[model samples]
Target: MKRLRYIALGVMVALLAWGYVAFNHWQREMIFMPSRAVGHTPPNGSFSDQWIDAPAAGGVEGGKVHAWWLPAASPEAPALLYLHGNADTLSTNVAAIDRLRQAGFAVLAIDYRGFGASAALLPEERSAYADARAAWQRLEQLAPRAVKRLAYGHSLGGAIAVELAATTPRVDGVVVEGSFTSVVDVAKSTEFDWMPLSLVVSQRFASDEKVAALKTPKLFIHCARDEVIPLRFGDRLYEQAGEPKSRLVIPGGDHNDCPAAAAGEWRDTLRRFGGISA
Candidate 1:
């Protein structure tokens, strides 16, 4: 009877171990979805490609992050580090960068490793944060004479922007659109809510916790009719963030079209938030 009990215990332990491993892999797949297929680059030589050399957490700078440098109408204008979402690359965000540039801000849209033309490796939370830091350094180096240094992140990039603002010291402002509080919070709003996902999600971007403690000036934007990330997630983050913060509710805007839907409002908010004249 004792031998049979021991065998049963061993089998249960093995099964649990296998389940944990499998669950983590699934979470990784669900979190970081990268694509090598780039959609398009800017036309008319509007921007230039700038490759940055920065090491990811627990990973080497095998190749480098590819960035699109869109300078403002002037060299002394504010500079923005454009951290894109998991599935986005520099090619997909030309209009986004252009919008900021038109507002008199130099935008550096970066492609993290494993995404566009960057190094091909699976991106984790820490690695993405590392890439943001690298991009920040490069942005500073490239635009040393800029008056302000800001960060703008969309979707998953929003979490990365929050992380960058929390860790960096010289950041002037931060803007996050269609962002979630955390991966767990997002999962809870989905069909997988019943599963115990928080335990296995190693790439958790806990922006809720980090944003609450950050003192930087922040602007949170959410699409009221967002189909990808619920409006509640961005709302929750806005509520959780401390003082020196504001929010914009994009009425009738979806995941990717908020700026176009509210172009005047968006640019006006940027001018006010970043103290820009353009």
Candidate 2:
């Protein structure tokens, strides 16, 4: 009976380990969803394809991330590093980029590794930050003549933007739209609230903790109709942010429609924060 008991105990341990691994994998899938392919095309003479070097991460070999460069008519116009959300590719946020261009800021929007035609690596929080930094380096070279540089991120990308603003030496401003305080908090507020996500969730962006320390100017925008992350998260981030900050809650639109539905507000934001005006 003693030998049988030992075997049962070892089997239970193995099964528990397997269960944890499976749960962790599922969490990552839910968080970092890379697109299957390059699904959309830019208009002729609208934007140019720009590729930035990405160092190896998460065991994936180093490769390049694809980007769309939309330069303003003036080389000295303010620039923005467009870090898109976890589920988005550059093609998905074309309207937002167009609005930024209209506001007179050169834009560089990129697809993180494992998304679009860039690379085939698995997406993770750390890898996304690495990708953004690499893109920032490219933007520095591409827009060196610009008067200033800003970082704009939507949803999960907002968390990455906050991080970039806090860590980088060249960022002039930061804009995070419809983003959450932390991925773990958002998950807890969802149906998965029942799950112990803190233990399995390794991709916690934790923007709230970082936003408070940034001295650079920031704009936190949210939509009243946003059901994905809720307006509460944006409010919390703004409240936690230090001085030289502002918040805009668009009366209409959802998580991703503010650029279209609240076009005037977006342009105004660019003008005030980035010194760009149409």
Candidate 3:
């Protein structure tokens, strides 16, 4: 009986140690689900080919990140630097880009280091932020005289957008949709509620802290029916943000279809915030 007890104790310790290492190693994959195969190109040749120089830390060697720029109907129209969610490429956001285009804003959307046709490598939060900065620089060079420039992000991209808006001096406004306050808060709200995520998780895309520091005009959009990220997260972020902030709640909007659910309201709010003429 004593021998059997010792073996069981050894096995349990080994398993626990393995579990800890494995969880830490793969936590970023669980957070960012990059899909390379399901990407789509821009429609009708309306977009131009744009690329940003890769970050020095990128796993891929000597590669340029891909982006698409769809100019608005007029050259003097306001512009949007759109950062997409974690799972897919910029092509996955074609519809949203189209919506913004129709609302009279030039749209510049990029594929982060790992997603789409940019490069084949795992992306970290810091590298992703670097990619956003590079894209913003390219956008500035491409459209130096844009009437107004806004940073717009959805889901994980919302956190990225908040960071850019807070840090970048030229960004005029910010828009976030279906975004969370922080990765730690999101983990707490999900199945890993019991885990000490703040200690274990490596990525800290804390939008709440960044938004609180921002003084630009802000707009938050959330779907009440969003299952992936609760609407309260968006509300909490809005609360933390400084004044000149607005929010639009789509009553029946899910995580993916909020703009479609409230199309008119979505376009109108963006236009008003961006100061785009009718």
Q: How large an RMSD does model 2 have? A: 2.2
Q: Across residues 7-82, which tens digit of lDDT does each residue of candidate 1 receive?
A: 9999999999999778666666578788776868876667888898877474334458888888777778889999
Q: Which ten residues in a row have the lowest lDDT in candidate 3?
A: 54-63
Give the per-residue lDDT digits (tens) of candidate 3, residues 5-82: 999999999999998667755866777777675456668778997878966653334357788999977777888899
How much does each candidate deviate from the true structure in C-alpha RMSD? Answer: 2.5, 2.2, 4.4
Once fitted onto the true fold, the runs of candidate 2 whose alpha carbons sit more than 4 angstroms away are 1-17
Over 4 Å off, model 3 = 1-24, 57-62
In terms of lDDT, model 3 sits at 0.85
Please give each candidate's TM-score: 0.91, 0.92, 0.89
Error of 3 at 84 (Å): 0.7
Task: Give RMSD (Å) of candidate 1 vs. truth.
Answer: 2.5
Backbone N/Cα/C clashes per model: 0, 0, 0
Stretch of 10 with least lDDT, candidate 2: 35-44
Q: Candidate 2, residues 1-278: lDDT per residue as tens digits?
A: 99999999999999999997786667667888888566675666878999888887654578889999998898999989988887778878777777788788899999998888888767777778889999999999989999999999999999999999989968999999989999888888878898777776877899988988899899988998898889988888899999889888888888778767788876787678888644
Show where candidate 1 strays beyond 4 Å. 1-21, 58-63
Backbone steric clashes in candidate 3, count? 0
- Give residue 156's lDDT in candidate 3 (0 to 100): 95
TM-score, candidate 1, is 0.91
Task: Report clash pairs, candidate 3.
Answer: none
User: lDDT score of model 1?
Assistant: 0.85
